[model samples]
Target chain A: GIQVEQSPPDLILQEGANSTLRCNFSDSVNNLQWFHQNPWGQLINLFYIPSGTKQNGRLSATTVATERYSLLYISSSQTTDSGVYFCAAADTGANSKLTFGKGITLSVRP
Target chain B: SQTIHQWPATLVQPVGSPLSLECTVEGTSNPNLYWYRQAAGRGLQLLFYSVGIGQISSEVPQNLSASRPQDRQFILSSKKLLLSDSGFYLCAWTQYGRGRTNEKLFFGSGTQLSVL
Candidate 1:
């Protein structure tokens, strides 16, 4: 089993501000992803970057596999972006089950 | 397009009652299915996973169980629900790969369960 830790357990930002969320894993992983859990409890996939960098609209993620860390960046934050962001990883040797971090709760104000 | 469906978006049941949640996937074959539970304001916990039909693996020892009776259908069941069973249950599926490199899960909307 792999352990995941997220930094800045809580974050607050004003509209148009930018924030970065980090995820650290206890071991190497073959898959890494960033997810946004909306207020309605729907988990939306943001990025599937086991390594390298990827961007989707105002969201982008980068995973450094060797260092066992990943980062999620939200730029020009909007009210709709207010939610819990989670990072999950799957170790190759494991049973292909995702180990999720506690999540970073984000709040955006108008 | 691939899509995952889960039923009874919300449920409320009395303690000790039997529980069953169903999840199905479309547009794919021989997909790997998973069941997860999330407590209020907590991270997701892996409950069970199935690599193929009739093959199930439990990640945690709990009151719940899971079965894959068909290729695209996975079911989570419990003989008797406990108060601790109250949580948001999510069903997800992904294509099988040689290793984790090809592992990427797509989750359903999830079911919120409340046990009294």
Candidate 2:
């Protein structure tokens, strides 16, 4: 089993602001992902980066597997981006299940 | 593209009542399927996972069970639901891979179940 910790626990931002949420894992992970749980409870997948950097629109993620840390960056935040951001990881190889962090609740005020 | 469908989206059940949540995947075969429960203000807890048809594994022990009767379907069941069973249940799937991510998971909208 792996331990995951998320920072800030809570965050508040104004529209057009930028924020960074971090995830730290205790062990080496083969699978790493970032998800946005909307106000309606939809766990929308954002990124899958066990290592390296990837960008998707206003959202981007970077994982340094060696350091066992991943970061999710939200740029030009909008009201629609307000939700719970989660980081999850799988310590084993393919087909393994994920262990998720508690999550960071982001609130973007218009 | 692959998608997962979970229902009834929301449910309210009396304590000790039977529970059954179904998750089905489309446009994919032999994908690794998983069931997770997210408690209020908490993290996602892995409930069950299946690598293939009829091959199920449980991550935690409580009052629930999972079955994979079809290649693209996974079901979570409980004969007697407990108050603690109330939460948001999610179902997801991913392809088999050998890389850092292996394959990214696609999740369903999720089910909000409240046991009274």
Compare the candidates by lDDT and give the number of the best one.
1
Q: Between which residue pairs do clashes occur in model 1?
A: none
Residue range B7-50, candidate 1, lDDT tens digits = 98999999999999999999988888899999999999989988
Clashes of each: 0, 0
State residue B54's C-alpha deviation in candidate 1, in Å: 0.6
TM-score of each: 0.96, 0.94
lDDT of 2: 0.89
Best by TM-score: 1
The worst-scoring run of ten residues by lDDT in candidate 1 chain A lies at: A89-98
* Model 1: residue A82 alpha-carbon error in angstroms: 0.9
Model 1: what is its DockQ?
0.62
Per-residue lDDT over B1-116 for candidate 2, one digit per residue giving the tens place of the 0 to 100 score: 77789999999999999999999998877888889998888888889888888888888988999999998999999999999999999998887522223678778999999999
Tens digit of per-residue lDDT, candidate 1, span A1-110: 78999999999999999999999998888888889999999998888898999989999898999999999999999999999998998887755668899999999999
